[model samples]
Target: MRLSTILRGGIVVACTAFASGTALAEDLAFTLKNATGVAVTEFYLSPSNVNNWEENLLGNDTLSAGDSIQVTVADGRATCVYDIKTVFKDGSNVDDRAINLCELGSYTVHE
Candidate 1:
């Protein structure tokens, strides 16, 4: 009976850990709106601690003025802060850093 109780307790602990890990690793979906007057030709989302930016999140797509795109923020781990960079069609670009993406369901880029 003691052995059975120990096994059950271990199983419960393992299941709890698994559930919490899954929750942290889950992806959060959000929308990005281009409030800039120009069209955004490229968009990148990278970790705050990373120096190099990731690949363009928008593949063959442009976010025009007042347009919004749905984006999934996932880095395969528990990371909430992110850096966002956007390149406009006119060759101008802007970068915003340290955004708490986990708490945001939508973001708007301006100017």
Candidate 2:
């Protein structure tokens, strides 16, 4: 299975599919773009499921408008919807959004 890539704003942000000519572990590249008006001082990424509340997978980065970040997810996992939020240093809130990853056509994740 040849992996295909999606370009976002001139960035080759992620590659889709498991591998070329065969199945393999899948991984997702969680890409975040600060398109909001305010600059986000912190952010969090977590799975939508699990009862432990919104756990933070990444944070503590000062991101300006148009700035972006990416994280890779382990492969062989099925598609899962995720929650993403941005927080300011002063405790102000920016936004909370959801996107699906791991499933084909969603954000690709490879192990």
Give the top-scoring candidate (TM-score): 1
> What TM-score, to 2 decimals, does candidate 1 have?
0.75
lDDT of each: 0.71, 0.47
Model 2 regions more than 4 Å off: 1-25, 53-58, 75-77, 94-98, 102-111
> Candidate 1 deviates by what RMSD?
14.1
What's the true lDDT of residue 18 in model 1?
80
lDDT of 1 by residue, 20-57 (tens): 77443566567788887899888888779989987887
lDDT for model 1 comes to: 0.71
lDDT of 2: 0.47
Worst 10 residues of 2 by lDDT: 1-10
Measured by TM-score, how close is model 2 to the native structure?
A: 0.50
Model 1 regions more than 4 Å off: 1-24
Counting clashing residue pairs in each candidate, in order, gives 0, 16
